[model samples]
Target: MGGPGGWWRRKSTPAKVETYTRWSFHFIALSEPTVIGVTAFGHLEARAALLVMVPVAAHVALAMVTASRALDWTVGRRAQPLRLLWALGAATALVATAAVVLGRHGPGGPGEDTGTVLGSVFGATLCYGVGLTALGLKDRRRVVLLVTGFGAGAGLVARAAGMPALAALGTSAFVTAASGFFAATSAFSIWLLNTVYVLDEARETRARLAVAEERLRFGRDLHDVMGRNLAVIALKSELAVQLARRERPEAVEQMIEVQRIAQESQREVREVVRGYRRADLEAELHGARGVLRAAGIDCEVSGETDGLPAEVQSALGWVVREATTNVLRHGDAKKCTVTVLRPEGRVVLTVRNDGATAPHGSSRTGGTGLAGLRERLSAVGGTLDAGEAGDGEFRLVAEVPLTARPALEVAS
Candidate 1:
């Protein structure tokens, strides 16, 4: 036996709750006419009771179908079969109307002719039809006109049929149509509200997916930045160990280089984690030259690094950094050349290195660093290509529009 708090925590989902509520209304609506028909049964002849009950049962069944179709319409789904059911419901109501009118004048007719029993049956059918029409009709003005016409028409027909003077023709028809109209409107309004709730839930799901994708992109960027830098530091430290075994004084210099790279890596990682880090193209060009030269590779940089937008520079700076790191870690390169050009409203950066040594069982297509760069460049409407060019040379090229857009704005 859970407490009230626990029961609330276990409450049904919106879909299940709505379904239960709709069925509850259906049962309540049908019960009223059903009770009336049963009570009138005891007072009438056996043949009269059979005539009244048959139409009442048919009307109830068709009304349920109509309500179900209305619910479908509110949620943007089609209930094509409902047109037939609507017609059947209306036909059964008319039959019940005829039977009730004839019963009042029969040998076993009730004492008074208040028209209460007939109105209840007729009103239920009208309510079902009105509710279905309100949602199925796309035009609001048309729905209003149709509802008004239905009410007025029902009243006029009742008046012409010669109901009792006290429950005059006008009074009888108005009561029936009005009862149906209000019942239909209330049910349709509830269904509309539930539809809105479903749409809101879908929007929330999309928002959450966007957030998750951004987080994944950020994680990939951080991994790309750190992975290459750490690999370079490991190579330097290993080289220092060998030099130390040979008892060379250059071992101390190698150790110092390792220490410097380690410290730089720490600062870069902090900057990346803070999310405000923007790579400098000039700094990367200079750093690439110095690092390649120290590794005994002749490096030449030819480019104007001035007067570029910050976004373009940052994206290209990453290209240069990753290319330099790849040359050191993966190749036995004797020389490397980097070129930058602004042509046709785009800035292009290319890094070409000789003595390329392809990794064991490595395809030209995949690497975390290049893949991450491609994603980053694409965020600013840029592109990257990295693969074997020809004659023992591997090339990495990146191109970006001069007026690069921010990644956040692009995502939006």
Candidate 2:
């Protein structure tokens, strides 16, 4: 039980939606036997009911199998279940015909009410089978046509079996309405599942694009930093080579100048790398707000980073980043609040979001992101705490001891 629960919780949104949809259709198919069987038993003897349920059981099995395949096709996991659809349609026609024959010619009871019970079963079977067939279809017009065809077939068959014209029309209308409802439901479910998957893919694409964009920016910055120095070094080296070839003492000075420029380039590269690694708290805060708002989440930030130590700001900035990412990736958050407070000798940073039932990566279930954050904060004598705050809220608090900053820096 625990293993299954954990697995479910770990599933991404699209996986969960697909799982739910597949199982829902299976259960719907399963329910047909129970509902139709009970109605059959209520109207006929046990033996007669059993006879009627044999084909229903077969129809249900075919529906379940077809629906499963259809769902796979919907997700591009497999081809359409055309053979199963035809088999199910045939089974549905057989069952309805059996019901009609039993009603018109078989033993009767309760003012000949067997016809009424069987007619209802006919409609239900048509509904379930038609809906299952619709799952494999991608076109709205085709689904409409499928339902209409089944309804018309039901009425025409009834009329040939001696049902009054008006009664046959009524049966047709009933079957159409019932089958249309289930067909529409199946169509909508497929649409929703597809939409969810598309949105999930789009989100992942957006994240990848952001990473690529950042890489380009970093490359551009590095180019700008190194371009001029390298050009000058190349020019000076050529001049040095010419002077050396001419046996001039100026070659030595030119070589030294080239070495100096090379060393300066190395230093600038280190500065660029260091700046890239260090996170600025003020920039992170505004960036988080912009990103969250762009994703349609409301973000409220409260706090000032003025006078905070560089190490403290860097550690807290990382916390904000990880928290924001988790909110976007794991939870369906509508609003988030980030607060920073300085009390006594410690700086406290709190990030809260009303999107999760339980806090993600609480101490009990340490996650990679949170563990990395803890390591970063621990370097600066900080501690991290995360837990649920009730009413579908999760909060993460990080506190860094300001008084220990000097000692930490000295130790580092």
Candidate 3:
């Protein structure tokens, strides 16, 4: 929770807030009677009611104040402190427990001080156990104990006070149900806190990683764009410089052409990053068709590919791009087939091409072709297979999951 104002705000969606609100109401309903016990059943006389309600109310008010203060400090204006709501909840449970056990008495004849103390003890102990159960619900180690304590406490109190059998049964049932609900609710609450922490960490980590990756990619693009061209430009510039010494006109003109290609390459790299360079499947396939034809390779690509997950389709498109690149650039293949299949349970993409000009460069394609494809496929939780699928053929296949982890990050 961020604060009173921001405790309601959410990062991923508004639905988590809605769910949290529901859980809060459920918890308050289920445990309020335990906290404000005699008000519901008229099970206690006035003095007994006073004894139990006072301490319970005090504990709750203090816990809320502590939680609110910590939330304000941590989220309103400053970094998280070493504030301990878990300890505060634990302490409340302890004090309530002590208040309860010390005041224990048995049901007795009316007008007996002993009976008053005993009622206080029964109601407070029941509520205290329930309170502790509610408090440490998010703390996994203590939750089991608190839940067990609630159930056992209800049964013990019922037996001690000679409550009616139905009353005792009702108490046990209520405690059991409450224990399960709170345990689940608390688990979900703790998970929400952890997920928020993780998302912050993930953002920071991705920032650093994205910077590093972008830097590396920029360097690669620059080399691809300007490496040989820069060398040519530098040689021509030297020629122009030397020609200036000789007062020659043509050397300087050649230098101007060199400058033009370098400028165009720079503009293209910028465009690529800005998404001006479209790499759609149809255009890729249309290009591939021509390239394969020039290489004397017959290509059979089938089906209208639709409803494909973006990552999967992108990966498959990449397979087609790289395979076609390999065929035109390196392979002496005679034929290629790019098949796209969407069967009931899985999607499949296969690219098969005839063997290389040489026997096999797949033994060496691992340097960039196969290795990069594997990495891309793995990122989408898919696999890539590259090999001579049969005699004198090279193939690559990518398969990916359609859906995973159904989007409920922190519902409570």
Index of the highest-lDDT prediction: 2
**Model 3: how far is 7 from its true place, Å?**
9.3
Model 1: lDDT of residue 255: 86
Model 2 regions more than 4 Å off: 109-113, 239-251, 274-412
Write down the lDDT that model 2 would get. 0.81
Model 3 C-alpha lDDT per residue in residues 96-192, reported as the tens digit of each score: 3453334343234434444444444444434433443343334566666666666666655565556567866776666556655655554565456
Q: List where candidate 3 sits over 4 angstroms from the true fold.
A: 1-52, 62-141, 153-177, 196-218, 238-253, 259-412
Per-residue alpha-carbon lDDT of model 2 for 1-412, expressed as tens digits?
4785998999999999999999999999988888887787897789977877888888898899899899999999988888988888888888887777667776663245577668666777888999888998999999999999999998998888788999999989988989999999999999999999999999999999988966754664455445545655666788789899999999998889789868967886786766555657898798678656745689999988899988899888878877776676666789999999999889999999988644354443477567667767887899898877878788989999997753333111
After superposition, the stretches of candidate 1 with alpha carbons farther than 4 Å from their true spots are 1-117, 125-198, 358-365, 404-412
Weakest lDDT window of 10 consecutive positions for candidate 2: 403-412
Higher-ranked by lDDT: 1 or 2:
2
The backbone clash count of each candidate, in order, is 1, 0, 2
Task: Please provide TM-scores, in order, for all candidate models, with all chains considered together.
Answer: 0.61, 0.63, 0.46
**Order the candidates by TM-score, highest first — what do you get?**
2, 1, 3
